[model samples]
Target chain A: MLSLFATDFIENSLMKFIQTSGLMAIFSEGGYKYVIMICISLLLLYLAIKHKFEPLLLLPIAFGMLLTNLPGANMFHAELFAGGHVHWDIFVGKAGLIDYLYLGVKLGIYPCLIFVGVGAMTDFGPLIANPKSFLLGAAAQLGIFLTFIGAIALGFTPAEAASIGIIGGADGPTSIFLTSKLAPDLLGPIAIAAYSYMALVPVIQPPIMRALTTKKERMIKMSQLRQVSKTEKIIFPLVITIIISLLLPDAAPLIGCLMLGNLMKECGVVDRLSKTVQNELMNIVVIFLGISVGATATAASFLNPRTLGILALGIIAFGCGTAGGVLLAKFMNLFLKDGKKINPLIGSAGVSAVPMAARVSQTVGQKDNPSNFLLMHAMGPNVAGVVGSAVAAGILLCMLG
Target chain B: MTLFVIDYPLPWSNILLIALFGIAIVFVVLVVLVYIMRLFGYVFTRKHKVTNTKAPLAISEEEVVAIVTALRLYNSALHDKESDMLTINRITRMYSPWNSKIHGLTQMPEHHNK
Candidate 1:
């Protein structure tokens, strides 16, 4: 009798342990999907580590995806944020590590903070020197609107379409800000697409740039820009923040934060604050933002036809954006006089990848004419692309939010 | 700020309208910025020009040159004459256990016989 009781106790304990193990959950019904999601995450990890494709964000994002997909770990709960509204009643009981971090994204705080860092690091001297670059910046947004129509035609809702179209902006934080507001469901795919394409700016932009412009147009050397004064530099961020915020109040958070950062940098009064924002604050927010955004890519959300469609449409949007900038620049040359004729090559930099896009313009131009240096000229449109995309995001929010 | 809210899918016409109007607004806003920046540039440049005109140098070019040359000569005269030589001096110091090679090396096992 004693031996039987001991045997029974041991058997029950073993059964309970086996039943509760995460490994067992993986082998249960409907478990293959989790395996697939995990595999995808691992693939992204490989890409991030080996290729260095936006590694800072992608690595954390990939790890978050891995954590959330571990069947029984329960690090993230999508139902808590179901239907694009946080279920605060159950949030405290059901929330996990990622849910807490995701609030920064849902509350529209992380992206704006990231923008402040970007602003501090940016030098607006180029854009201020050549205001016409604003036109090219506006022109690059053609991809965004065009993709909006395409996504709608392909059967996404207007809000979802807007979120997907923002990938063309080539501004990652702006993409996240718009998507988190307009369609939180699609945030994972849209962010991955935006960053991946941004990393590929050098690869993707050059072919389109080469195809669009003739050798002569590529070789066209722009005259040097006038020296921008310290006063103009200080006044620029203030004026831009006020004008853009007042015009489209929807853009206030992003534009205001960005301008504040630029002010901190240009004013030279708060060097420590500028350094902290540019380095420490930016790094912390990026880690949190990346992980939370990546955690959203569950099997149900990511392993679908829509993800495939977003990836396809995203590249199309990027291509169209590149073509738009180049074409607009060529068109502008028709009106611009001889010395003032703009190089169509610099137009491709209007996609807002910042110094990367500008560098591509320089590289392609140098290939055609060794003497040509389009980096500074390209920077004008590149920075303008940042403002242009913010305006586009604001417009989309007003129309479709 | 939302113009309209649609629970149902939007029609093709509305989609097109949003696209067209969105692009148009972006252009209009940026164009306004272009004009404003241009005006700002004009104002600042005009201020610089006025400052330049108002601040004509009191000293003539010849006088300035003469002053600079005399200052250069006086500065040269302040230095005492020395032999034109370049030398790297070596200084010796007493050894300390902190930096001595014997202290840095591991001690070898001592041979013992019983």
Candidate 2:
């Protein structure tokens, strides 16, 4: 009787342990997809920490991917997201903690909020001093259009193609904003591709920039940018907001928040508010945005063939955008005088990756001529690229969404 | 006529056309912005130049010297003569979380005590 009781107790304990184990779900439920996704997440984490690839967002995103993919964790419920439509009631009541935070992304709030912080931090002086850089900024968006065509060729929807193409703009927030609205289903792949390519700007842009430009072009020195007055700085954001809003209302939210932040910064009385927006608000939103965006990279969505296509197209978009900017500069040089010739390398800074692309231009230019300081000159196109990409996103939203 | 208007089912012709149109719009808008910025620069700089060229007040050198001396004496009398730089000791205090501008929506907490 004692022997029989002991056997029964052991059997019961073993069955309970097997039933409750996460490892068991890996085999029985998620199967191979779970293993593959876990490996991908680990790879992303390695890239984020070991390689220091945009770790601010990448680390959270990678961890979120890991958390959601762990079999039987029930952290992210796909049923809550139905056919590009979020069932808020289900998400709120049935889903895990991460799902609630993800609502900001689903509703396209986080990216716009991030733009507000970006605008507050950005100085429009460089752009205002040399307004012609706006052309380079516009020219850099060529990759977005080119990639849109490529995505379509690969059988993606117009909406999906538009989202993918915006990755070329190299602005992470703009990419997320457009993707959330146009092709929410492809948000994870598109956002990751956008950010990953943005982090890779220092690597990807230099080779193209060097190949396209002759030694003379790289060594060409630009004139000093003029100092912009406070009045012009204050007026810039307000005027831009009104003009862009009138032309493309779809861009208004992103542009409007950005301008509002800039206005607060330039208005001179709201230093405290501007500082808060730049630091605290930006940090908090980035944390939430990173984790939530990462959580969306499920095996079902991320492992698809479409994602592979997007990753491929993203690099092409970035490369083409760089080329377009450089080529435009060369084209403009034809019209310029001997002393007024613009450095073709400055044009590569026009892809909206901000200071990174601009810094890369400076680095490459300095390699050819150590005395050359292209930082400020490159900043003109660099900042203009932000406005250009926002405008491009607005146009895409107007056309496709 | 609208060339290759975007609609559901996303035809390649429409997608290509949209891309062209999109690029056109980006260029046109930026061109407009560039011109506007140039206009602003012209107006502001021209105004600045005009202001710079305006005649100065006709104060004699003696009067200017007198004014400068008086101002310097006044500053010396009121300010610290020993230290070139002003020293400030900030009060260290613990406050509620609401003191953070990030937390409080109404107003930022004052740095110095009233």
Candidate 3:
């Protein structure tokens, strides 16, 4: 009688409240391996907090990871890809509320939405002020190419190579954008690699930046930007959208969505929409995205050697892109009229890591010579890098998929 | 009967699909990279420059490059300084509070306070 009572305590209606009927049925394969991934996420969270890496994102991601791992913790049913996001017990075959939240991430909705916020917050003024920084953006993409080659050599198919190579760009939305459309199954690892590398931007970019530039080059100071007209500022996004749309129709969805958000902000007439996209929309999407993405990390899928390789290669891709951008800048300097000296350190800003790459450029420049500041100037290339990588991703999708 | 229940290893078709997915991502990253490089190259080689920090209010090539570097940070788009004031960040020298706008621009180390 006492044993029966203990069993009842272990399995009671109270447990039913926490876990939905749908979760009670399914046989979760690879029990122990799954636990390891949960541990990995815990480690990442601890490292993020302890080392003070991107705490804002890492902490949330860690929490999401933790919630996803506990048995019957159906906070979100994790079938976000199918549109019905509710926690469900596979055993009893009943879905719950947790699945609803997973819908946003599984469908690859959140990152794109965050882009709207990013688009709103972005200022193309510096790029317009200088316009030349776009080259650095192009240069930063060099790592993607080198990484692609490496991925292929490592036995990744052309498609796998492209996905892995994109981690070099350091833009999470684009990574999710491509992975979701191309390889839904690999989304979990790819997303993990992209965000992990993005959080590690400062650590990953500096050595390559310093190795490529001399103290003299780091000390190079640029002139101020010319005043841009409002009309010109307004026309810029429109012109880019038109040209890119014509160039890569397949890339239209990703580029179109990104530019549409940017256009709303730059046009200056849609202040309300831009504000919504930047604040409320971005916040809601980030929460859903973090949780859904965490659910995909089932141990069976995430524990492959390929995942490890992708992570390692991601670092290389980022470094090479930074080096590529800086080297290109230095090469350009040779042809540039006497006073035009491009700071190779700013070349690191060529990666699509956005503000982080720009910050790295500024920090490195300031450290070498406090008098030297490269933040605003790096914008020209940083935003340009974003556009460049998008076009590249679009073209690849067209050719391969 | 046992043979019918045997586990089928994950397929090459799945792997192929996975590889195709990767290609899409790299392509985007590269296109973005090249476009940025070209855009900056155009700005760097612009016909007229406004002022170089070395010389007040006059745009020199060095100043052009330096300003481009400074302006690049604007790429982050979190310009709390002018960001608070206007979405359009451009202002003519006459409108600036200081006639020596470029003079103290890099001086005083404003970001140092942060």
Candidate 4:
């Protein structure tokens, strides 16, 4: 009995044989990763339904997460793909039936296509109407840079730190684009953190906004916006495209595609193309992008010590962004004398989750005054956050890549 | 990164240098963009203010007094407006949840006041 406690395993031939067998080998290698990924999926589901955060994204993301994490989950992995790439194509009659279609993300197609759809849906009128909103947008990104430094200080390489930092964008498409370019291995955890925190924005941002501003400031009424003319609306995206492309040529393709889509949408004459981009094209890309991204959550690639670090840093990035925007708005308010004050809640909308950040802004503002309506006003900074994050992404690509 | 993963290397120092460089770059760019934007906003804002202040006095005192009189008339009507007991008795016959004493007590004031 004493010998059994510390004996060499080979001496127990039957137990040793089982350990070496196919079924047990597969189970031992993959079981823990599957379990942990499943737990994370369940947590996302709980947040989506119970807390009702970014439910549309969380629900699909959680479902895709469940699809990819299960051992031998053929939901994504197929005959064509292995590791993370597609190799030789079958030229013969009897071809491989299975296909691991990782091309959606690996080729870097879905994220850019998603950006086009986002551009089509976005209204740049707010940013153009009040260019100062760009400051809040820029301030919102302090978290990403701060987190990059923190990740590097904690021993992640610069590329790894950059990939991790992009999650703070609160823009999943940008995060995916940067991660695909910078650190493909970290895609799964980085994406999971980005989308998860975006869903938690309602929870995370309100507290930050509350902590930073007083009830009086929250209740401050903003003046009404002048109705943006159709001609100005049509011109805005073109001007932005030129400005951004001239500054960072690396961002040209993305900014160009996005602004082109927006141009089609705003141009009064192209209803057919706009409808297709907004509806059919957008839906197909979102579904493919969601599941394919989910497919990257295989246990072996996802479960690492660094994953824990990425998760912890992600929250820091999000919180810092919120603080930066609020603080910047307060700083600007120094000169705008009299009763006028920039509602600090609008600062959180600068993180670029668009309507989610806007809704969070509106919700926080409502807490101070039931009559205060900030939804439309907050949208200016919200859209600016998208542009700001893209510019920041371009800057990183230039400096690091 | 490759050096640290393989042979012994001072990866920490490299990372520190990269981080500081990134911070300085991002800070300088953001600060300048912010400053220029504020300056432009201020200049345009001052011009807009002068233009706005110069607008005609078209919204005269008579309009204010007329709007106030109309609001007073509506307020008096709403203050006296109420449903009869017969209308309340008819609703009680249609719904059973309205029979709950706790819920009924809370809602009674709103319906009566209205």
Displacement of the residue A175 alpha carbon in candidate 4, Å:
0.4
User: Model 4: runs farther than 4 Å from truth?
Assistant: A1-30, A42-55, A73-100, B1-114
Output the worst ten-in-a-row residue range by lDDT, candidate 4 chain A.
A91-100
Model 4, chain B only, scores a TM-score of 0.40
DockQ of 2: 0.29
Sorted by DockQ (best first), the order is 1, 2, 4, 3
- lDDT agreement with native, every candidate: 0.92, 0.89, 0.70, 0.75
lDDT of 2 by residue, A1-401 (tens): 99999999999999999987778877785478988988988998999999998898888888888888887788877678767778866666798878878888888899988999999988889899989999999999999999989888777788898999999999999999998888887888888898888899999999999999999889999888877999999999999999999988988998898898899899999999999999999999999998888888888988877889999999999999999999999999999999889999999989988789999999999999999999988888998999999999999998877
TM-score of each: 0.92, 0.86, 0.71, 0.73
- Best lDDT goes to which candidate? 1
Give DockQ per model, in order. 0.35, 0.29, 0.05, 0.12
Residue-by-residue lDDT tens digits, candidate 2, B1-114: 432234447655776789999999999999999999999999999988887666344656689889999999998889554966788999876877857756766466567868
Q: After the best TM-score superposition of candidate 4, give how far the Cα of residue A20 lies from its true spot, in angstroms.
A: 14
Give a tens-digit lDDT track for model 3, residues A1-401: 99999899878867975455433433355556646767888897887789866666666666776666666655644343433223334513644444565555545577667777777777877877765676677667777767877776666666667777878877887877776666665667787788888878898888888887888888889876666656656666676677677767766666666767787887889999988998888877877776666666665557777777787888888888888888988988888875667777777887877798899999999997998888988887888778777766776667555
As for candidate 4, its clashing pairs are A78-A99, A78-A100, A79-A98, A79-A99
lDDT of 1 by residue, B33-100 (tens): 99999999899889989988765476677887899999999998897889899898998878999888
Q: Compose the digit string of candidate 1's lDDT tens values, residues A282-347.
A: 999999999999999988888888899899989988999999999999999999899999999989
Q: Give the interface RMSD values of the models in order.
A: 5.8, 6.0, 8.9, 4.7
Most DockQ-accurate candidate: 1
Worst 10 residues of 1 chain A by lDDT: A67-76
Candidate 4 CAPRI grade: incorrect
Q: Where does candidate 2 chain A have its weakest 10-residue lDDT segment?
A: A84-93
* Whole-model lDDT, model 4: 0.75
